[model samples]
Target: MTSTDSTRSRWIRLLILAVVAVALAHALDGVAWRSARLLSVNDKDWGRLLRSMGYLPTWGVIALGFWLQQRDHPQRSRYAWALLLGPALSGGVAEVLKLLIRRLRPNPDVFEYAFRPFADGPLSNRGMGMPSSHTLVAFAGAAVLAQLYPRARWLWYTLAAGCAATRVLAMGHFLSDTVVAAVLGVAVSTLYWLRWVEPLPAP
Candidate 1:
C-alpha cells in the first residue's frame, strides 16, 4: 500500500478510537448521574421531551424523509440501502440479545420483556438492561448516512444523539446500554463501509 493510503487508514482508526472513548465516557457519566437524585426541573422537562421523541411516530417520519431522499438521488441509492441495512441489522441483533438476556424495561408496569411490544399480561420484562436498542438503531442509521454525506454529517449525528438521549430520559434503558449501542452501531456501519462501499475514485 502507498504511504498516503497507510496514513489515511491510521487516521480513520484513530477517529474510530476517539469516538469509542467518548461514547464510553458518556455512558459512565450518564450512569453516575442517573443514580443520583440530582435531576432539576429543566432536566425533568428535557427528559419528558426526549421520552416523547423516542416514540415510533417521530422516528417514522424521519425514516420516511430518508426514503424519499434516497428515491430522489439515484446515484446515492446504494449508500441509502447500506444506511437502511445498518438499523435493520442492529434492530435484529438487539432483538436476539433481548431474548437471550431477557432484561426488563425500566417501566415494569407498562412494558414486559417480550418479543412483541404489545404483549398481554403484566409486563414481565423488568431487569435485563444491557444495551439500548433504540440508541443502537439510531446510531446505525445515523453513522451510515453521515459516512455517505460528510457535508451534513453533524445533522445526522445530532439526531442520533437526541434519539439516544431520549432512551435514557424515558428511563427505557440504562446509560451503559445506550453507550454500547452507539459503539456497536458505528462499528458495524464502519465495517460495512470498509467491506462494501467503494471509496471515491483517485483524483
Candidate 2:
C-alpha cells in the first residue's frame, strides 16, 4: 500500500486506541487530577506564550511562515498549505466534540477537574472541556511538521507536547484531557494529510 494509505490506516487504529485511552483516563480521573496539580507551574511568560498558540493571530503567523518558505521552495507549495489546515482540521473535530461531550472543565483559578464524556448536551460548553482544544491544535500543527520535516520530527513532538502541557497548567485541564486530545489531534491530522493534503501516488 502507498504511504498515504498506510498512514490513513495507522490513524484509524490510533483513533480506536485513543478511545480506549480516553476511557481509561476518564475512569481514573482522580489520578488525572493529581497529575495535573503536580505538573502545573506558575510562569506568566510561558503561560502567555502557550495561550497564543491556539489563537487566530498565531495561525496567521504560521501561514505567513509557510508562505515565506514556499516562495523559495515552490515544489512544496502543493501540499504545504496543509500546515495551515492542520490545526483547522483537528480543531474542527475538537469543536464538535466539545458541543457533544460538554465535559466539565477545571477553572483556570481552580486547579481541579474531571472527564465528563457524553455528560453534556449539544452546544453545551461543559462537555467541550474534556478534549482540550489547545492541545488538539498543538498536535495538529506538530503532525504536519512531523511529516514535512522528518529530521526535526522530535522537535515538533516536543513543541506539540509542551503546548499541551501548558493547558494543564494554565487552565485546570486534567492530564487526561490533554493526553487524549493530543492523541486524537495527531490521529485526525495524520488522516487529513493522507486523505487531502498529500499528493496521491503517481499512477
Candidate 3:
C-alpha cells in the first residue's frame, strides 16, 4: 500500500483497538472493579513518583526535551509548537469530557467508593474524573516519543502504563477512567504527530 493508504490503515486499526478496549472495560466491570481495588494502595512514595507526571512537570520535561533535541537542527523551532501543544490538546479534550460527563471519581480515600455518574457533583469535582488527564498526558508523551524515538517505543509505552497505574493505585481514578484516557491519549497524540508533527512510521 502507498504511504497514505498505510497511514489510514494504521489509524483505523488503532481506533478499533481503542474501541475494543473500552467495550471490554465495560463488559468486564467486575474484573475492572476488583483490579482497581487491588491496585488502590495509598503510598506517599508512589504519589511523589507520580507527581513528576503532573501537568507542569510532565510538560516541562517535554519542553526541555524539545529544546535539547532541536539544538542541532536548523528547523528545530518548527517543531516547538507541536511539542508544546501535544499535551494541551490531549488534556483539553479530556477536561471537556470530564465536565460534560460530570462523573465523580472513586473516592481518593476509598477504592470501593460508589461511582457517581452525572450527579452534577461538587463544582470542585467537575472535570476531575471520568477520563484521567494524567494518563492522557502520559500517553500523549508516549505517542510523540514513540514516533520521535522509534527504538524506545516500548519504553515510552511502559512508562505511560506505569504512570497510569499510579493514578489508580494512588486512588486518584478508576480503572475505566484511566483506560479511556489511555485510548484518547494514544489517538490524539498519534493524530497530531501524523498530521502536523511527524510522518507515520512505515508499517
Question: How high is the lDDT of residue 96 in model 3?
Answer: 80
Query: Cα-based RMSD of the predictions, in order?
Result: 6.8, 4.5, 3.9
Global CA lDDT computed for model 3: 0.70
Predicted structure 2: clash tally:
8
lDDT of 1 by residue, 59-159 (tens): 45655666676676565555655656667777666666665665455542343233334353233333455567777777777787677677888887777
The C-alpha lDDT values of all candidates are 0.61, 0.70, 0.70
Q: Which model is ahead, 1 or 2, in terms of lDDT?
A: 2
- Please give the RMSD of candidate 1 to the true structure: 6.8
CA lDDT, candidate 1, residue 189: 71
Instruction: Give the better candidate number (2 or 3) by TM-score.
Output: 3
- The true-versus-predicted C-alpha distance at residue 43 of model 2, in Å, is 4.5
Q: List TM-scores for all candidates, in order.
A: 0.62, 0.74, 0.79
Model 3, residue 160: distance off in Å is: 0.9
Ranking by TM-score: 3, 2, 1
Query: Largest TM-score belongs to which candidate?
Result: 3
Model 3, position 84: C-alpha lDDT score: 63
Off by over 4 Å in 3: 38-47, 107-127, 199-203
**Model 2 CA RMSD to the hidden true structure, in angstroms:** 4.5
